[model samples]
Target chain A: MTRTTYRWAALFLALPLAVYIAFVVFPLLSSFYYSLTDWNGFDVNYNFVGLANFEKMFSDRLFSNAIGNTLIWTVAAIIVPTGGGLALALVLHERGIFANIYKSMFYLPIALALAVIGQIWLWIYQPNWGLINATLRNIGLENLAQAWLAKPQFALLAVILAWSWQQTALSMVIFLAGLTAIPQELIEAAHIDGANYFQRVRRVIVPLLAPASVVVIALAVINSLKSFDVLYVMTRGGPFHSSDNLAMFMYNESFQKYNMGYGSAIAVVLFLITLAVIAVYFRQSAQVERLYD
Target chain B: MTKTIAHNDRRAATASLASDRAQSSRVPMIIFYVLLTIIVLMYSAPSIGVLLASLKSTAEIAEVGVWAIPRSFELTNYVEAWNGGNAGIYIRNSFFVTIPATIISISLGVLAGYTLSKLKFRGSNALFIFFVAGLFFPPQIALIPLFRLFNDLGLYDTLWSLILIHIAFGIPICTLILKNFFAAVPTAIREAAIIDGANEWQILTRLMLPLSLPALAVLTTLQFTWIWNDFLWPVILIRSDEMRTVMVGLASLKGQYSVAYGVQSAMAVYASIPTLLVFVFFQRYFIRGLTFGSVKG
Candidate 1:
């Protein structure tokens, strides 16, 4: 690149990079600094407290519960969306006419805001008038109906189900793309060998879909880590904070309780976990790309 | 004659076998449609149920199951939800936050993406990786600090805070998408333009920008949906009721109208309309944007 080209590049890149650094990088690094302090987000004078917040976090029951719930959420996010999406994609991949309609229906939830979906599910889970219990009672299964979002055992699961509904469409679309890329001759050869539908799917289709699965699973994990809005709107991580994930825990601690130092510590932990996940994702995806090549 | 007879028998056997395969496939085909219908219904029930609930009166919503249609369609529920109190204000605020945020982010992204992909300056690859890494940084990690930063800047409790934060966070994905898009544009075009004495600016504006309309459209739609549907930033940044975006407004609206299911549902439906329209109109581009970001990135 010539000097003039270099100058031009600098001019073009300067503003956006500056804004990004100011808002994104600077704040992120400062959060790391803040996590080591006793700053409560208010006073000017506070002593540096090293690892004290981390120690407190380890002993905190809510924090541990948040971690546990996050793990459950991540696992659920992977299995439910990937499994449901793969099934739907397989079924819809061969059915062209109705595939459009089905895809639209499945993807509709993704278009809705998390807050709106949270509200919708809140109403659906309403004990008396919500759809679930109402249907259960209408079918003479009143004994089975319970407050879906109110119970500790059910709250996290309920939130996960709603999240999975939104997520399945994403996985399905990715899988559909993957399924499309699979060679038709291979499936035909399997059929010529008299492999039944189940055998074909299990042996041929699912194995070929491993790359897509890697992408879907990575996205699901990252998404589960950031799960907050729905839990905030639906249960507020309530019924004794059973559904509070790391994000919500961070929010409540930092903003609601003004524990800036502790919140920053939690944020750092979440960020590291996210970074690790993304690292694995990139590594696996690189291998997948190599295989394709 | 015997050889001909053997060939005919073999043909009949293969024909029978083909027919049997077809016959067996019919059953699974039936089961496939049945399963597809069930899944579709399950997926669409929430949206449909909410829409139906939005059309019912509060009394009807309470007295009957959401599955039941109202005795009369209360279209006024939408009007009430919009014009009644702060829903209209919230909707307007969302537009205020979304449109400008989308435009600014896309513009900055295009410039940076072009420079990185086409210009090939020193450290450009490193810079691109830096931006890409931003994608993995969970927003929650930055919340408290950004909250404090915005407060220090006196941008808190205002739409600018939300807009700026959205633009900042939106840069990573937008730049990634556009960088890839610009890279795919034939370098020969750039070479020809350079030979014609066209500078980087003219080439980008005249040649690249025009060619990148499809990519720009995808980025715009995706970013619009993202900023429009955002809840976390606005809830934390904009404390004033009038300044609140629709998502936060809808949350508070739920609190106030907890018993008014029809009205709340109407607001929820209203909040979803813009993105839903984008989805309906640009489903292909939207899905492409989504899959491209994940699958390729």
Candidate 2:
């Protein structure tokens, strides 16, 4: 290609590159800079309070709870959904009947906007006449029923259950793909060696499908950490801020409370934590990168 | 060889297989059906319950158990909700913000992705890595600076502000996904186009863009779904009721009508319809698209 053509291609490239740098890259750097100062969001008269916001973050009770809940949310988001999804996928795949119906049903919640899900579950978690508690009581398990999103102990867990149901469909899809890729010969071989279905799954299927499992788990964890909509809607990080994740805390501090610096500090910490986990996950899955293609 | 193994076990295997078939068929099918039904109930309960409640009067909604049949099917709840809720305006606001954001983000993403994958430019790897790292950075961190940035630029409270934010945040991951897609395109085609004395612009426009239709379609749907459902940026950036996106509008509605369950449920269902239609249309490709943006080549 001559210089003229090369210049045209570069011109095409320049438009997106300029936008990317201005919006994404610029804001990120500015946020980092703002984390060092005490700027009330709307104020014009603010000075750099070096390390003060960071100091407050270290000692803040809500920040600590947010971090702890964020960790729990991440773990439960990965574990609970992953187990349920794989189990569902295994059952649906073996049956090969009503699979499409099941898949569509499972995926319904994911398609709904997060606000809608939050609103739907808010009613479902209503303590007195809510379906969950009422159903338990109807079954003569009255003691088992609880105020799901109201109490501090069960608030995050209840939200996680809702999220797990919504998210697991994607995991199931990934698992189904991985399951299809596994050579059917291996499963037949295991069956010939006097293995039952359970044994074949354990011995032949799980190990071969480890990559898909990792991808699902990693994605779930990241998504859980980034979750804001439901928590923002249902609880607003309330009942003593027990439901507060890092994302919510950041929003409240920066926007609601008007503490931009402290909020930026919290946001930075959350970013570091996410990056660390992803880094570790990638390192562990190095041998399988070949399979990604 | 595979057929011979089955042949060797003809008699004993036939008995065993018959027993296996009988046992597995009757028991597991029932168990599977039960389990699947339970799961379906779990998933569909809230949505169905909400829809039913929305159709019921406030009194009936309050009196009946969530799963119970409504005493009467009343359309007033939906009619009143739409009028009082200003949902039509909110829906329009969402379209205003979502459409431009989706187009700009996808277009920018495709360009950045195409350049990085197809063209041998200086610092492409570095730029791509930067974008990948952008994925890991929580949007919370940037909210403050962005708010200030938008305010200073006098772009606050408008759909354009939200569109810019969405495009900016979306590009990194979108570009990452598009880069992988462009990489997967056969280089031989490019070489063939080059041999025919076609310049990069003509070749990319006439050749690459046409062949890359599947990726373009997938990216468009993904971006459309994402922008339509976005909550945080719109919520923070657009504070006025008139400028509010549907998510924020729903949030405001929820707060206002916390006691009015029927009205709120009706509104929730209203906001849910557009995304539901998109999901139904792209149901086959939804899973692939979701995984494609986040995962590897």
Candidate 3:
């Protein structure tokens, strides 16, 4: 009976496992192999590069810029959305008149495709005739008006801020759920103990909300690192390639430039960097121990 | 004695009802409303812009903010987008890829999640850990190899190729979610089913599966929204115009690189309608799903 059941379980698992290995595992391993060789994607003949691709990568200014942009986006993305979401969640968790409406509304932006969000932001950031500059002029802050996306200094920051608005909704939902799980009795107890609102939030609520924060922050970092659509649509790494992230760089190098070996090398670097970051996060936070336990 | 018991029940009900009313009128109520309104406006800005833009003509959009009410409301953009822009075909391709991928991921996810959660098996922990690690590896890292592999297999530029790729990457998160849900199911129920001589498959299909409807509903709605809005995979995998999903179609429609704001905005609205409709219909399920996983803490 036990043997039969084990066989049944194996049967259930086999197909997905096989498919995953074929598409996911094998491709990744092969990519790593190709990263060491000098193979143009469309080329008929190629030779082993022996880390020459990687050696060239160290001096590549554009590659470094992409990495910097990715890190900046990751940090800013996590901080802004997580912070904003916490405030929204706290307000809504108090059970106001339009609590449900607020949640549904905040969630609206997330439902639209990234393509749409990118296009909308593009219109908003138009240099002269755009909504933003027009609004600034109308508000008597004429000096504040500038070319938002066209200017190299503000372009990536503008894009990141736009991305944050949509993401905060998800983070808010997570935090709201976290808030609800805290027993009302405990909050009342804290109040009775003379804890002010800010104190209560800091000492009691935030600690209780740690798990949700972990999930939201981890996801935010990963998503920001992987963000491609908005960057691709709005700027295509324009303004002298100031807005490019690792993913965009990978795509541009591989498909646009036809440098398969170099692209694979960059990808391998990204893959390793992501792994290292996650490992460091886990190690520093000791989050995994608490999360699984 | 019966009168005393009935009298106590009446008193208890009234007391509970009064407390519920008291909680509603708490001091936090006013602050909640104002904050919610502000946050909601911020969230809906982009979608609202798209809707208004889609209703205006190209010429009007260039002249005014997308949020402006058109002097003459022109809903013709929607018509043009659907018929002339081939949005109909793009939307069709989206559904074709999405439905099959959703079905495969959910079914496989539920099975794998249940097995990992309830059943004892060798290599289970290692496999689970392996998948969890896979979650953090950016898909871009595998793009070149996957593309080449798909090309070699003659699966490039097809919806099946895209669906298969979606399912592969989707498995980890889906399985993780379902496992979390399945673990919440009571052990006693499984013990009872086992006592009845039900096989593993029978117990899964007839007993556990039926009880998991809420979680499955949540998964379905979430999967539909996610798979529907996906852009990167489709852009990378499918090159044919007819094979392009709605997101990619709208993306490529950007006229002369950056000047198609009017038509692109129109296409954005068109692409959003289906998912927005799904969102409106399944708002409760979607909310419950997003919150449910968090609430278990």
Candidate 4:
């Protein structure tokens, strides 16, 4: 490239690059530094604690519970949404007026903020007058009614259900796009070969949808790992911290408790987990792309 | 003669079977529609409940379930929700943060995305990858340090803190989308513009940008929705009640008015309207932005 071209490019890139480095990169590096020290966020005379924070995390029950809950959240978040979305996509992929309306209705939750969704679910899970319990009573199945978000056993599951509701819309949309991309001739050929509806789906549709599934699964996994807003809004990892995930644990520890070093350690761990997931996702997606090629 | 008769009989049997199959398919089709209706109702229950509850008095909400239509519409719930508390200020704060953040991020994203796509300087690929990698970094990692950094910079309790954070976080996806978008514009257009004595600035502003209107719309809507719906940054950065975004305000409203489900529901409805409007009006672009970002990346 010529010198003027070079100068123009530099000018174009200067502001974004500077802002990115300042806000994103600088904080990331600072988190790494803070993770190893005993800084209380305000005190400058804090000691270098080395790996003590990381070591302490292993012995901390709350940290362990957070890890476990995070895993549960991630697994459920992936499976429920992917499976439900795929089913919805299959059912709704056909063109019709009703199908279009159903698509919009299913996608309605996507537009609402997570905080709002959480609050809505929170009210829905209220014990006395909430929708679930009231519906249970109206149906004469009052025995099934329980405090969905208050009980330790049910809180995490309740939050996951809400997350699933919001997440499935995006998954459905992606899978619908994937389904649309499939050539009509393939399905027609399958039908001409005497393949039934289930047979056609199994042979032609599902296999071809692997790429969309990869994208959905990757997004679901990453989103679950970073799950915070809904949980924070609904239960705040309440009823004995049973619903707390790693993100909540980090936030509570760092911001709430002001344990800067420990929170940074938790942040580092969460980052590593996310990085690992992204790496796996990239590798899997690359393979999927190769298959298409 | 017997062979001809047999062939005619087989044809008749096949026609009968085809008719049977067609008739039988109608049953499943009916079942499918029924199932779809149930699913739609189930999916829409919460939103419907919230909307209805927002229109009901507190006593009505308590007396009857959210499923029941209010005997009298309490339109005052919305008025009260708006004027009663900090909900108005919080929503205004969200707009203050969302609008400028959207404009700034999209502007920078266009410039940077255009440069990275067309300029092809050394390390451009690496820089692109760097920005894309930002997508994977969980915001929790940045929270504590960003808090301290903003505090040190005296932006801790201000709306600018959330604005800057949103812009910084928004760059990756915005730039990625814009880069892909600009790349799709054929090189011939740029070459012709250059031959016609247009500079890079003029080419981008006058020639390329108009062509990229769809992508720009997608980016603006997506970024606006994201920044508007953002919860974490506002919770961390803005301490004052007046500076809080809608999500943060709604969350706090949940605690403050735990007993008054009517007002809380009203606030929920109020908070959802802007993003909901975007979704309704720009539904195609919204879905396109989502699928494009995920599938292409």
How would you order the candidates by DockQ, starting with the best? 1, 4, 2, 3
lDDT of 3 by residue, A37-78 (tens): 888886768889899999988899998998899888988977
Candidate closest to the true structure, highest DockQ:
1
* Evaluation by DockQ, superior candidate among 2 and 3: 2
The top-ranked prediction according to lDDT is: 4
List, residue by residue over B136-227, the lDDT tens digit for candidate 1: 77788888789888889999999999899988988998899999999999899999999999999999999999999999989988999999
CAPRI category for model 2: medium
lDDT of all the models against the reference?
0.87, 0.80, 0.80, 0.88
Which lDDT tens digits does candidate 1 get at residues A1-293? 89989988998998889889988988888889889987787777777999999999878999999999988998898899999989888878867677777778888888999999899899789898788998899899999999988899999999999888888888998898888878876876687688888999999988887788898898888888987889889998889998899999888888889889999999999988888888888898889788866
Where in model 3 is the C-alpha error above 4 Å? A284-293, B1-39, B187-197, B256-262, B291-296
lDDT of 4 by residue, B76-183 (tens): 778777887577898899999999999999998999999999988889999999987888888989888898899889999999998899889889988899999988
Better of 3 and 4 by lDDT: 4
Quality of candidate 1's docking, in CAPRI categories? Answer: medium
- Give residue A156's error in model 2 in angstroms: 1.9
- Put the candidates in lDDT order, highest first: 4, 1, 2, 3
Q: Please give each candidate's TM-score.
A: 0.95, 0.93, 0.90, 0.95
Question: What's the lDDT of the predicted structure labeled candidate 1?
Answer: 0.87
- DockQ, candidate no. 4: 0.63
